[model samples]
Target: MTTDSSDLSQVDEEAKLDLTQQIRDAILGGEFAPHQRLIEADISARFDATRAAVRTALLNLTGEGLVERLPNRGARVRAISVDEAVEIVEVRIGLESLCARKAAVNITDADIEELRGVRAQIEAAVASGHLVEYARLNQEMDRRIRDIGGHETATRLLERLRAQSARHQFRLAFHPGRASQSAPEHIAIIDAVLARDPDAAEAATRAHLEGIVDVLRHLD
Candidate 1:
């Protein structure tokens, strides 16, 4: 008996999401290096998925800025140009600083405690050398901080930039001592926010992004 078209469509969508996540994790985990070509046939073979499913996954990744597809060159992990990298940092500096400033004004005691809890988890991840977990916690902390601003527009923009930012952060987190150094920086921001000091919170956010920009500048 033939399956319904809707059932077939649902299965296809699930396959695409699964493969997209796998490819995204691989790229973010450095298995798929920046600018590394992604051959459809190879990916299809490795994942035991249909070429169509692989194509859809690649397209989804491309939308997320994790994959790039060129006319004749096919797909590859998206490589940020120096200019693009600098621009991303500049955008982050603006958005995050604004979020911190607003968070300082609107954040409640509960917010501070929740943020502190996440910060503690991040510290634990750092101490244990769980680099991946640290990155995930760090991202969560940033999201929570942004949510304190209560500005949907700013938060949405930051969220889009964050996906691109993750690629850089994943690479940066791997460098010796990077995660350790970043932990205290986050503490400073948390402290400023907890104190409801808008200026200090904004400055702390800017300083953190500046440090990231410096690191990106030195990368090959």
Candidate 2:
């Protein structure tokens, strides 16, 4: 039964979403590194799809600013400049502050529990020095907060910025002692959210974002 379902999905390309997702997964999985040029032919060959499909996928990634399309150079993974990094950090602060504030009013007990589960896992990952797990859990926490906040516009804006900001953030965040510093900030934000204090949640979340900014200053 599982084989049949998987077989049926093989030819499903009506939406083009699967193709886009595969490309994104490839990028996120570290198959492609920052500033690595994407050869359309190679990608098409890998996916067993047409050049058109590959081009479409590239265009979508470009639109999201995750891939840069240069006139002569073609597409490469986007790289963030220090200036861009600062801007992204600023935008993240505002978006997450909004998320924390809105979440105070709308968060359910189940949502709170889900956040706690994510937080616990993040803490464990930090303790074990598991950078990959830590990054994933960090993203999950951000996503949960955005979802619970009920601020669609702010969430969408943050999502777009994050797509481009990831390389810089990943570099800035996983520094030797940085994960340990970050874990408690997550706890503080969650504490404020659990208390249903919008002001406290907003402040706590902003403080957390600023903490990252401070660490980023020390990056090589």
Please write out the lDDT profile of model 1 over residues 1-220, one tens digit for every residue. Answer: 9899999989888878999889887877778888899999999999899899999999988987878899999999988776687788888899899999999999998998899899789889988999989888888888888899787888877766766666767778787788878888998998899899999999999999999888888877
Q: Mind sharing the TM-score for model 1?
A: 0.77
Residue 39, candidate 1: Cα error in Å is 2.6
Among these predicted structures, which one has the highest TM-score?
A: 2
RMSD of each: 3.5, 4.2
Candidate 1 minimal-lDDT segment of 10 residues = 159-168
lDDT of 2 by residue, 1-220 (tens): 2567665556555536678878887876678987999998999898888888888889988888878898988899886776777778888898899899999889998988988898788889988989888888888888888899989999888987887777777785668877888888888888888888999999999998888777777677
The list of candidate 1 runs beyond 4 A from truth reads 1-18, 45-49, 125-133, 176-180
TM-score (all chains, Cα) for each model: 0.77, 0.87
Q: What lDDT does the true structure give each of the candidates?
A: 0.86, 0.83
Residue 156 of model 2 has an lDDT of 80
